[model samples]
Target chain A: MSDRKNLNRAVSVARGYDPYTSEWLEHEFESYALLREHLPVARTEQLAYRRQFNGGWLLTRYDDISACLSDTDVFSSQSSDYPQRPWIPQAIDPPSHTAYRRIMNKWFTPEAMTAMEPHLWDFAGELLDKMLQKDEFDFVADFADPFPTVIFCELFGFPLDDYEQLMDWKNTLMHATDGHSAGRALAVAKAKELGLQTPDEGELPSEVAGQVYGATAAALYEYFGGLLEQRREHARNDMISQLIASEYDGERPLTNEELLDTLFLMFMAGLDTVASAMGLIVKTFAEQPDKRREFIALMDDSQKLTLAVEELVRTHAIVLLPRRVTEEKEFEGASMHAGDQVMCPTMAGNRDPEQFENPDEIIYDRVPNRHMGFGHGPHRCLGIHLARRELRIGLQLLHQRMPDYELHPDKKPELFGGMKGASSLWLRKG
Target chain B: MRVEIIADKCQGHGMCNMVCPSVFKHDEDGFGYVVAELAEVPAELQDEVRLAEVQCPERAIVIED
Candidate 1:
């Protein structure tokens, strides 16, 4: 068959299994492996297979995706023409995006993250101690969820008591991958339920369309208004306060809107990505005892935990970076048009056989490890240093305290919903 | 090892000076201007140097053997 005919056939086969169908679990698993094998770059009807908003093209090939990430000129980050959610700035192209990023970059540096380490360790240790008392607990809900949640709360000076509520909102937002509109509706609904008016469903007198547009702006205005006020009065060594004190263009500081938008981005970007990664890390370590032991040995020998954290990120890349095509571009002979959205799957990119030997398997000491877990180029994750520290401290303490931890065989991990995480990863503590 | 600073990229982040004051001192520009070179770094200061390297916002400084 001709290439076009072959492409058509492949697309049909891909569409045969709905990417969002929870009932198609077997098909989804088979497709994940099959797509990687067959058309690693083939198109699909999967909403996530393409950019959710504009039906733009998605590129799964490792090299093409990386190139897209580095080449920001052809891709725009502005949400002006595209249909996007409120917290989409991090995924936008650069230049304009850089201003917002600059406002909050300092708070996520290694020094800032290190300063927050004591609090993170205390939180992780407290959670682990409680889990150890039970000796067997759901890893995702009991451990993975709380690790990033508490760390983020303490780091930003937000109340730790709000973690569960935040997690529910986050879950609603992230797990809507399949049912994009419905999922987002549910997320907005949940956000409203939490007394925060979402753009889609706020109690404004405006029309539904206007409400959708104004809800996020209004809610954020109110949320950060209070925060900005609090920080201006008493600068509490937290992220919000730091940003308030920060000067841009040698001016006073970031505006209230900017602060709220960034904080919202932080919440959207942080929670699930780390939680998913933690689940993957625990699951991977549990499955491969030798590798886990090797990680422990590396931590013990180096006494510097960042190396292990790097290895963990390299091994299981959680978030895939998405970019939009601004002009007609051809990558590897595939003609991509202007306005096509491309996703650089960091997991797939990190596992490229050309990049790493035995790409599918985890290499505990994968040296010369230059993976795009945080991404490459200017728009890389601002909070990467902080995330790395949290991962290092959380993993090290967990291993040291509960050395003989294992996945509980009674409860098989259910990888359902829109998340690629184990629903309930039960573990037996040492 | 000597530490070199590329001033053009430096945004006066102050992270380097905060991390390793002895090894790096800020100039009038407010950016970190490396002031010292040591062939052998003390054991206590190793973490400080590593932290400085990791914390540099502009990635303007390079430590070489």
Candidate 2:
């Protein structure tokens, strides 16, 4: 039963939705329903500072979002502000994207991901053991955050010791704001204007956040540059080595910049996404014991486990996919111009009532659940197999180790929007 | 039912192969394609073939009776 009050708030948010305000993040599903029903082509002018687009249309309905994702020619991934440099494959359009993808497809196949299962299970068991040692611990910090990040580091050949520092960089890049109280006040005023909660402010302060973000990116480029050189000298059995050995378009080796950019994308995309998914999903389970019990009952059955992971991912879909309009066109009753932005919140599309019979309900065995959780079209997540394996293994080991757990009464889970994640999720064993 | 993956639409999400590996296998580049011998789904796997068809995010699978 959707709350009418939430729907009213969502309607207000749709009218003047600002990316920086975080209002839409709080009541996301309600916002999705209201926008999909009332304003299928919702428009917002308040752009994030680093974003290039001045104004954009938000597509809430599944069909519209899917159509946008599929038509790469019309809705280009080259929407990033960083035109001088782009994340390989992701920001590239076909046939270039196709070529880049060809080089990578074999590496992320279901078979390849399946090979990593034993190692993933072992690592998850180790982490879960450490986590269960404490009666009450932060799920995000203890299990969710480190579990995926460590696995990603091992795969990418990054040092395990640098995970903390790398996470700081990622946090700064993804979540940190200008840190200006004036800006925060303005955003709060805007949220108030929309009759929403106070905006979730970034932890880091002004100039610091920007500096850390910039420095972190530069450090990553430099770090990868050196690693690539070492791999070139004598290739190891790691992703960096694999990239070094693989030819680009069956031509020459990829340029240093290309290698660096690809690694950069990998670092950002691989590190935090699954961790966020875990945080959100576990938080959901902690709050809903019935769902937790259902999940635990199905844990031993592989097929049911797979479907459960998919359902959890569908319900907790996190990415807010952005695209650029390459040419002027009339789309879904909205006039999209060349150079305009299109925000396709997968979270919204995954929950659209028009697409699913009961959009909000998490049906573990929901078939044809072609949800946009991993996105759609050519830009579908390259790590889909790995992500699924990680989520499944993570859930399995978590429930096996601690069958019954609940949120800590004193500590609260901190959820943030825009590639939404839980910064803090404290859980206690029963 | 006989099934085929539309090449142009298949971006290799590999959901088909995951759903029914016996019927769906991927090429060297990992894009899903019907196993040549099993392109015509066995009676026992007909349900799985249909599941794979709908699970495909790209809607690349075309099934015929």
Q: iRMS of each prediction in angstroms?
A: 7.6, 1.2
TM-score, one value per model:
0.74, 0.91
Instruction: Please report the TM-score between candidate 2 and the true structure.
Output: 0.91
What is candidate 2's lDDT per residue for A325-404, written digit by digit as tens? 99988997688888888889998899887677798998998886888899899899999989998998899889888889
lDDT of 1 at A32: 42
Q: After superposition, how far is residue A384 of candidate 1 from its true place, in Å?
A: 1.2
For model 2 chain B, the run of ten residues with the poorest summed lDDT: B11-20
Candidate maximizing lDDT:
2
The lDDT of model 1 is 0.62
Candidate 1 residue A254 Cα shift, in angstroms, is: 2.9
Give the runs in model 2 whose Cα sits over 4 Å from its true position.
A1-12, A19-23, A48-50, A178-211
